[model samples]
Target: MTTVAFIGLGAMGYRMAAHLPQHFDSVLVWNRNVDKAKQHAAEFNTQAVTLAEAAQADIIFSCLPTSHQVDEIIHQVDIKSGAIWIDCTSGVPDIARTQATYLKSKNVSFLDAPVSGQTIGAENATLTFMVGGDAEVFDKALPAMQALGKLIKHVGGSGAGFAVKAVNNMLLAVHLCAAAEGFTTLKAHGVNLNEALDCINASSGKSGVTENVLSQRIFNRSFPNTFALLLLAKDTGIALDLVRDAKLSAPVIALSQSLIQAASATSDADSDFSAAVKMYESWSKITLE
Candidate 1:
């Protein structure tokens, strides 16, 4: 019988795991919060298992907060031989490589398959996966992964997926920071914020930030907690670490990281990432709206 175990049931994990039951004969879910797992099982008609019990499944999936938590979970559970572990955490590339090596020694396969498209995409089973592992193993896992994501690409080997994800978030940080500073300057110089955004959106300066984030969140002054500031800050730090490891200099990313870190300090860990623009507002004495 085909059995799949899903570890971690946070906002993204909970929704991502919901799709697994349709693809496997049996679905097992585990979370640090035992009650969350039980709740998911009750709602989805799956079984909730302990971490160790989860290790027995034919395929193991994890969507944790960081690579550190992923590392901890790997050691705690005595995973069965030949089982494949798919990690969807926004993790460090070096840690992913180490995990792959350790799992290889035990005859189990490992893939760093971090995802994008956020919580809404997770709920719809339309996320994009950047996977890194042996090409043959990826082909073997493709059918199972199709249940969770709409687009899945085998980026490279070992840690390449995590490296891409980290750099992706780092670029997002740059965009957000640059937009915040530019919009603040425009607002300060007597230009209407919405009109400036309109022009930018039609011009070369447009991005997802200007088109969506500026309109839905910043200008509305809602700043709802779609993505947490703390998490973005963490991902930016991971990207910076990757850059430093390569002996490269990234001044813009360095500055963006400092700004995101400082912005994270202004609010609770669960605060919306868009609230970061408020730091620029406070500095320039101008609001985006």
Candidate 2:
């Protein structure tokens, strides 16, 4: 029987793990907070195991806040030989590569399979996974991955998934900041925010941020806690690291990162990532709506 274990029960991980029971023979869960693990097991009809028990599973999946937490868990657990570790964290690329090399010495296979599409996508099982690992290993894990995501691409070897995810989020930050500044300019001239967005969405300036995040989250002023601004800030920093490592000059991304980091520092931990636009609004003395 193929026994699978999922570690972490955060906003995204909790929903992502719920899909595993349908595809695997046995599903196990572990969390830093034991009660959350128990709660998930009760709701999903799965077993809640300790960290040690989780390590013994044939396949182990983790979706932590960062690669630092992943490193801590990997060192704490003694994973069985031939086990597969698939990490879904928005993590540092260098750390993912290090973890992969360390796991290989113990006869374990590792994959960095970071995801996009945010919390709603996690709940709906429609996330896009950018995976990095051996081709054969990706093929072997495809069925299990399919249970939790709609689009899964094996981007490259170890660490590449994290690299792709970081760059993707960097672009997202750029779009959001650019949109915020542009909208602030339009608002200065007393243009209807709704009409401006409609035009922007129809124009070359449109992005996922303008169409969805700006329209749904920022304009509404709801600022729901779907994904945290702090996490976005962290992801942007990771992207900056990758950019600098490649010796590329990315002034826009650097500026966006500073804006996101500043916003995250001031906003509550539960604030939605779109709240970064609030900085632009504050600077322009004009609200989005």
- TM-score of each candidate? 0.96, 0.97
User: How badly does each model clash, as a count of residue pairs?
Assistant: 0, 0
Name the runs in model 1 displaced over 4 angstroms: none
Q: Tens digits of per-residue lDDT for model 1 on 90-200?
A: 988889899999999988899999999888889999999999999998998887789999999999999999988988888888999999988888877899989888899
How big is the RMSD of model 2? 1.0
Give the poorly placed runs of model 2, Cα more than 4 Å off: none
Best by lDDT: 2
Q: What is the lDDT of candidate 2?
A: 0.92
Model 1, residue 52: C-alpha shift (Å):
1.4
Clashes of 1: 0
